[model samples]
Target: MIVEHRIYTTHPGQVHEYLALYEAEGLAIQKRILGRMVGYYRSEIGGLNQVIHLWAYADLAERDQRRAALLADEGFRHYVRKITPLLAGQESRILVPAPFFTPTWQD
Candidate 1:
């Protein structure tokens, strides 16, 4: 499996607004299309106005297809429009588990 670590840094003081918007309008559409969401978090120390979201996919192909489907969704596009202004920076990392370690989701 592959894990995607998506980090979004919000313009100062906009983190709550961003998180609230995601919870109220973006979560469902994204979760439905993207599949497994390992976790969602807000940074309190190193980076103050940042949100980190973790997602798991079976492989690169699955990730690409799902992301493409998500991009095509009008609702998600609208949400993106809403959130874009609040973001200052963004980063994405694909994680491959080590040889001796693997992660799985029971559900």
Candidate 2:
């Protein structure tokens, strides 16, 4: 399995606004398409105004397909329009777990 780690740095004081927008508009659409959310988190320490989340996929191909579907959805596009102005930066990483570490939970 592969894990996609996403981090969004919101504009200075806009973390709450961003989170509210995501929870209200984006989460359901993403959950419907992505299907394997590992977790969602907000920064409380080192990086202020940061939102982080993880999603797991069987492989890069599956990830690409789902992401394409999500992007093509009208609801997701609307949500992106609403949230983009609040974001300062965005980063993503694809992670591979070690052979011994098994991920037992998803969604």
Candidate 3:
């Protein structure tokens, strides 16, 4: 499996607002479409105002398909409209687990 790491850096003091909006409006639709979420986090020390989340996919093709579906979702689009103004920057990365590593969590 491949993991997609996403980080959304919110406007200086907008982290709370962004998180609240995500929890209320974005989480459900995103979770339903993405399938596997490895982790979700907030930066409390070094990178204040940043939200980070990890999603797992079977492969790049699956990632592409699901991301495309998410973009087409009206609910996600609505959430995007609401969160766009709160964001300062965003980043995404793809990760592959090491040869000796194994996931412990049940899927």
Output the number of the TM-score-best candidate. 2
Q: What is candidate 3's lDDT per residue for 1-107, written digit by digit as tens? A: 89999999999989999999999999999999998988999998897889999999989999999999999999999889999999999999999999998887525
- 1-107 per-residue lDDT for model 2 (tens digits): 99999999999999999988899999999999999999999999998999999999999999999999999999999999989999999999999999899988843
Work out the TM-score per prediction: 0.96, 0.97, 0.96
Better of 1 and 2 by TM-score: 2
lDDT of each: 0.94, 0.95, 0.93
> Between the candidate structures 2 and 3, which one is better when assessed by TM-score?
2
Clashing pairs in 2: none
- What shift in Å separates residue 94 of candidate 1 from its native position after superposition? 0.3
Supply the global lDDT for candidate 3.
Answer: 0.93
Q: What C-alpha lDDT does candidate 1 achieve relative to the native structure?
A: 0.94
Local accuracy of candidate 1 as per-residue lDDT tens digits, 5-103: 999999999999999999999999989999999999999999789999999998999999999999999999999999999999999999988888766
Q: Output the worst ten-in-a-row residue range by lDDT, candidate 2.
A: 98-107
What ranges in model 1 sit over 4 Å off? none
Model 2 segments more than 4 A misplaced: none
